[model samples]
Target: MRRVLFAARSAVALHRLLDVVPVFAGDARIARCFTLVPGSDFGVDALAVVDALGGRVVPWEEACAGAYDLVVSASPKGELALLSGPHVLLPHGAGFSKTIRAEGSADSASGLDPVYLRRAPIALHAMAHPDQVARLRAAGTGAASRARVVGDPTLDRLLASRPLRDRYRAALGTGSRRLLVLTSTWGPESLLHRRPDLPAELAAELPYDEYQLALVVHPNEHSRLGAYDLAERLAPAFDAGLVLAAPREEWAAVLVAADALVTDHGSTALYFAGSAADDRPVVGVGSGGPELIPGSPMDELLRSVPVLGRGQEIRRALDAYRPGAARHAAEAAFAFPGRALERLRAELYGLLGLTPAAATSPRLLPSPAPARRMPAAFDVHAGLIPDGVRVARHPVGLAPAGHHLAVEYGAAGEQVTLSAGVLYRRPLPSGAGWTSGGWTRHALDSYPGCRTAGVVQPCGDGVLRFRGRELPYAVRIEARVEADGRVSAVDPAVAVSAAHVWVAGHRDWDGGRVVFNCLVGEREFRVRLREATEGEAGAAV
Candidate 1:
């Protein structure tokens, strides 16, 4: 028997590998260890999953020292330096949603790292779609020659078990009610993190008497907000009659029961697009602006399906959603449905120089339905600006990590107003002074409380006014934004010299944008600013 180790760095990683591990466990010719990478953070979901997998845990150092015959990882990060065996890279999720990585950087999961592509000796890369292989090759990942399409084993299992939808619906006590599933992936750019009122807004717009709403949040969000804490934060929506599914429940079953889906751009949307049996309407909620991968599955879905803006009403979006185009796109994206697990098993076994065991009995994998109406669990990474206004100084186009001026704000029952402008930084002639670096472009969001690409609102003489709206009491300007330039936070002078923003009329800096944080009765408001010298003003590139 050959020894194989499945190493993971986070709970999200474990979810990705869940489809493959069980098949390996059923085999007699393979010895497997499902363990964590030493020194990596483990979310509550990951811990719960690890416990359920018979606690086959080992430290990264210990596993590498064990002389495992082969090692399988989501990415080549962590203590991979300790491993001496042949390696395989099975991505934890699908899509090229993240920003492009530097040639040799191991900072992201897209697997475009130069070392992994060029010299780290990756033996095989099992991809979810053939398009991914082309994408990898385009990105110059070293393993193009070794890439193979194995479909997605998770989707395979879920699609094959479509009958479970009835059970899931029953378990949720949603008899005869059309279930609307809302999924938001974790990150500052995620829908709920920026627009905390999305659930309430959506639920309110969707007739409660006609349809039932269920929310499926990302595990990273649960880790950022403790499971219980996240659940508490979303309690208002739950109380308003939204069904919060349990984290441990198979997302497949939840999707199975959904009559329609409203989601952001993430793995959840990718999988849902492929596995929805009824070919139901998939309503995409755009980040306040256009930030989707053009021609990718997400873009395809948006083009074919009905898409709503960040703060748009649900009923209106749904009325325009068409299901035919989505079905066609799904067929193209996931070609070998229902055979993914079998294909994955064959490929991995071949890589290990062993014959896979004979096929098991013909029956759906055992996926139990979760209990009815669980509390919502929210998650987001820390250091994210939460429901507030933030200001950070950097070169005209650079954002320094961990250096932000953020303030949380809320109103009870009144509307808040916001507007903002930028001051560019540039070097002056003859060493006399540094002034404006380039044209001042003011940023605008289509909606008030979500992270979307900043729409460049043309301005005159370094002044621009964003359209304002009166929102419900709990709104905030929580978008992922920054100035464009490189400058260190440690150097106060350099930071001060960088381009920045102010709330138009106020002397105080209010970020690239400004917000009026108040309820109908409150007199108080907040703004974020970074000090700058007089010479830095009117700096045009």
Candidate 2:
């Protein structure tokens, strides 16, 4: 019997694949399955099916125990390390389908081969188009020799499943009629999240009450201020008829049930296209490129599909490109149930010299041994800053008890010294230089005391006097380094403002030899100081 190992990180993708893979493989059973189960209410339909088919389920770290004839992985991140045997890479078809490869760079395609192509005596299969296969071959080693174009297995589920249009409508509280499911795919870096003018764009269009709107939220979004959250928050203002679906996965029925679709540049759009076909009026909102899969002939099929830059345009296109009697096109477009498992089995059988009957029967694939934990007692090293740098003290004032004083040095030789003290009344110049006239001193004996004095004698670098003590000081200096090699002070700050402040100090990254500016404020003041390095200023004299 062929020992097959299937590993996936996402329960959603696994369940979706399991929905149809069993039908194609005949009695083929899962030998071992490894998955991550984050404690979320999201159901694992795929794991359920695997158990029903007699597959052993285990934790993800258990995959390395025994040799396997075949391995299937859905995680792109873990695939490279898991390529000991013939492997099928099923990257969960999400944002990856629409990822634009950088120009003249095959990083994405080549990155896939570390687990598939270079592992000798193994085969690679892609659930993408022939063009994708060609691209992978062009970009990856041994890919030209091994890669094959098998359609996505997840698409097969939609194709094989009966259309629950009425059932979905009833669940959504909408009557049996045409519905538009707007799947939200918001990105953190996109302008859609930061711009203020987006509400008008969505509001000007999609005002139809007859078209029931279901807003599907992305899973990664954390808060309402975020792009996905903002879309959800703004969705109600644009259309009171809109329904927001949170904790995603609830929209799986919606994807298969909706008559029309709207999406951003995400994999859900590809799933809809790959599964639904070009039958329904699918609109690509806020997309700059072609409406179909890049580097694929599917673009020809999606030529008539509208790619809208604005919400008004999307609405107009939706109204104009209504599905013309192609309501049932989704089923036909994504029809390849059990194809993924069959392909997986064929590849495994070819590599391991096993028949379908033998491979499909129950067999024990050894469990991966538990990881060896390191001993708690290990050699540890700790060091302290050298003595030489003088830590400056903050001036006392009627501030909070925990409030501390800090000195911030900026680039361009500027400095901001902040401390709580009684506002001294002195007519000071208030210019660049500090003078006795600028400040009106109001002295009240406070718990924490403050003192300042200067005694100058050197024109260049030499011994200078401060409060009767002789110390190394400089006038009109660019930077100040103490005897311990730590920063003593910096002159002339750059980009200093009431809201933002910059300070210069001796940084560790530059061999502890160069000065770098860092931000200083209420947030950064709490950081504790350690020992000083050589050449840093010693105690303030």
The most accurate candidate by TM-score is 1
lDDT by residue for model 1 (1-541), tens: 8888887777777777766675574678787777777554444457568777686777656886787777887765566657778877787665544433432453433455555555456788888778878877876765778988877776776677787777777676554346888888766667687667787666545433236788887767766676577658876666545776555445667777788888877657767777776667778776423334466665566567776764446667777876576666665556577777677778778878887776632235454344444211111111213333232222111122223221111111112112112111222334323122211122123224321111111121222122242110111221222245321111111111111122222435333333432110111123222222233333332
Models 1 onward score TM values of: 0.64, 0.49
* Model 2 C-alpha lDDT per residue in residues 1-541, reported as the tens digit of each score: 4566665444544544453244225545435454443332332444554576686776554555556666665544433354356665554553233332432233343224344345434366554444555555665566556666555555544444425544555566554235677765435422244333443344233322123555555443423244355555565333333455532234555666677776555455555655553467776555424322443322332344566555556557776664532233222223243265456556645666655564331111111122211111101111112211111111112112222222221111111122321111112234333222111111112212212111111121111111112232211222334466643222111111110111112222222222222222111111112212223223221
Query: How well does candidate 1 score on lDDT at residue 167?
Result: 72
| Model 2 stretches astray by more than 4 angstroms | 1-3, 10-29, 36-57, 82-84, 94-97, 100-122, 186-209, 217-250, 288-304, 309-314, 322-541
* Best model number under lDDT: 1
Distance (Å) between predicted and true CA of 369, model 1?
5.6
